[model samples]
Target: MAELISLDRFVDVLQAARREHIALIGGGGKTTLLHALGSQLGGSRVLTTTTVMGHDQHGDLPVVFPTTDGDVARAARNRAVIVWRRIEGKKAKGVAREDCDRWFDLVDHVVVEADGARQRPFKAPAPYEPVVPATATLLVSVIGADALGRVIADQCHRPLRVAALAGCTPYERLSATHAASVLLHHRGALRAKPAGARLVVVINKVDDTSRRSVDELVDVLHGRDRALQVIAISRR
Candidate 1:
């Protein structure tokens, strides 16, 4: 049943979450989830931004590099706004987390992609990775269900780190237990989650063939962290 946790539940979780700031971390599908949440939250004053992101991945929202509260208020008046500091080559640099904290009161919701995974389906974070905001009230950690059964060297964003966390060789085939090790590790996916924030683990890209492995993964996660909410979703 946990393997069947749907995207609809993911949306419902985000919709019910509060504190005006939601920060996304970990790997798989952060950007897509950010946009989807922003649209589904149905806020006219929703603000989407990233700690780091491709300059061209702004989705359809109007981009605003705000320097003042009035700047944000003016641009985010009655529409979704994408905020960034400046475009640095292929990447759009994000504002400081302090800026996000301040903008919390300026908008209905501020959704931030607080990590970068180089588009890999799965990842294990380095010490400085996952720049989650201190003010974030909700933290969403994403993992790819497809990473199971693949060679970590070929499938994970940071193979060495994943290997370190999972206690397997970099070239070893990944298993549900291997993925569980990272999810349960304090320095892994839960690295920077704020104490007051709600945490949800999202196991994404589920299909019929992946159900058993996904179920196994959920069982391991809950076995270790009874408070954790794990949501497994298939494609839209």
Candidate 2:
């Protein structure tokens, strides 16, 4: 059986540096992972915005919308800070990648949720999607293990794009092979990845039912690209 690790341990496994910018992409557990990392790192971490996220997702963390560099510098001094441009209805609009880059030196860790999945278990990127920061030092691509065995059209965000990437019809059942293909494809989950950044693939919501599928996906991914590090976890 594969080992299950806590999100904090998973952050440790990534060997994230204080000065690094980490971008979370794909679906399922991106926001959960961002919050976990923020909590784990404690003070000096900045949860900056990118893509579209829920307006009230920050929990008790102090928020600075339409934030300035000075605001980030101040909030990041003793605690984790959530930075954004403003709130638009139910969504919190994030600052630009360029804006995030400007504060790379001010915070200990800048965690960016760089994609939106409409709360789906998995997703395939559309062209001009996944707004990753150019200065990102690590990119984590996530997918839910629950996505396996489900109909692609029903379980995934951008079902047509996922089908196109996996070379299957939308109504087809998702297989380990299909899941692996989507994650490793150049224009799939790895899209908009920054140059020279380390890449990590996270398979979340692993359990007895999804364990075999997650293992198969990991095996296939490693077999195809040894450089890719795959981690499976139950992110609850």
Candidate 3:
């Protein structure tokens, strides 16, 4: 198996350039990836959030709830900033997809968390989920290597949807084939993916125990979608 690449190299692999909108879907370290990319890209990057996220998800980045275009222009001057609508209790609600387009005029890069997984390692998107912006140039589908050998119901969000796509019951163990099925499924993690956008799959928590699973999953993905890039990493 290949060694885990550095986060900077990971960003390079994604080909994330300035003035591009990147939407992160699926589960397993989406927030971590978002911030890591934000930190790496620096300069005029706006994390235009879309899904429900925790209040502290941005760490120390200045957060701006842009009620007007002037506020957005002001936040875009910073090296890195989080743009959202408001914080409800402990969760931060993201602005609508239409509103996300407005930030492009101010910032160079926009990173959007398009789905919610409730801290689970893997997930299948529900019908009305993953609010990905149509203008996204990159779509990253994330899953955890640790999900291997565990029951789908125990470690996956929307386990029933996963089971349906994987052709198994919730209590069944999550095999590499099953994982591949979920990722490759049109309406699964890749839902609402833009036509011309680059698609990358990130397999997180790739320890010794999960290496084989990651490899198998990658093999399956390549076989099905030759253009898709599969990367294995240990975000922890």
Candidate 4:
């Protein structure tokens, strides 16, 4: 199995934490964290299919629609999460508004993917994006070291905004300093995060030369505010 982060602290914090719903965001290791949590639970979870174009969950976990009928919802009571497909290929698929109304009552937990489809290291908003309710208990944002300055700008749907935020003329202006700033900026967005929901920062792709040591970044983040906790990993 892939090296797993000991989630005991997280489990303790969230088992009775305020928020009931949790959404994973950002880029690096989002799926890895999801699978790690799901696998740790070692039980059935309703893995809902999503519209985000990428690899599929190869497991046999039972999946049900957010629009599933009452009977279907009841049938999926044994599921761990309802993998809601919000956007398909950068377009909104369904918002899970009605789906949440019907099924949220049945499941013990609902793990939503708060995916921002821009595909760049720097986050950007999209049209008809899935706006998950603020009730999400956790928001996990992933950041890959490799994406810090390259693919995010080169392949992003929009590079201008990213460059502007990074205060660079171009995406190429991104550097370790830029990466640290972006991480901190995104982390700041969670300042008003609800008491129940936990915001986790996952620094991934440590295998990449650009993001090898997080000490500088960690020091910077904590230097600003020592309350934050960050976990670093490489899913290469």
Query: How much does candidate 4 score in TM-score?
Result: 0.69
Q: Whose TM-score is higher: candidate 3's or candidate 4's? A: 3
Per-residue lDDT tens digits of candidate 4, residues 111-205? 55556544444453333433444555565656655565464466433456445545665537446465555545533335334556565566665
Better of 2 and 3 by lDDT: 2
Task: For residues 1-236, write the lDDT of model 1, one tens digit per residue.
Answer: 67465565667754554435788877778888887676666454545555678888888788888778779867876567888899999989987777887777777778888888888888998888787778888888888878888899998989999999999999998898899898778899778888888888888888888778889888888888887888888865
At residue 103, what lDDT does model 1 achieve?
79
Model 4 lowest lDDT segment of ten: 1-10
Best lDDT goes to which candidate?
2
C-alpha TM-scores of all predictions? 0.91, 0.95, 0.94, 0.69
Candidate 3: clashing pairs of residues: none
| Model 1 worst lDDT window (10 residues) | 41-50
Which should have the higher lDDT, number 1 or number 4? 1
Residue 221, candidate 1: C-alpha displacement in angstroms: 0.8
Q: Which lDDT tens digits does candidate 3 get at residues 77-176?
A: 7588888899999999988887766676667788899999999999999999889888888889999888888999999999999999999999999998
Report the candidate with higher TM-score, 1 versus 4. 1
lDDT of each: 0.80, 0.84, 0.84, 0.49
Steric collisions counted per model: 0, 0, 0, 14
User: Weakest 10 consecutive residues, lDDT, candidate 3?
Assistant: 1-10
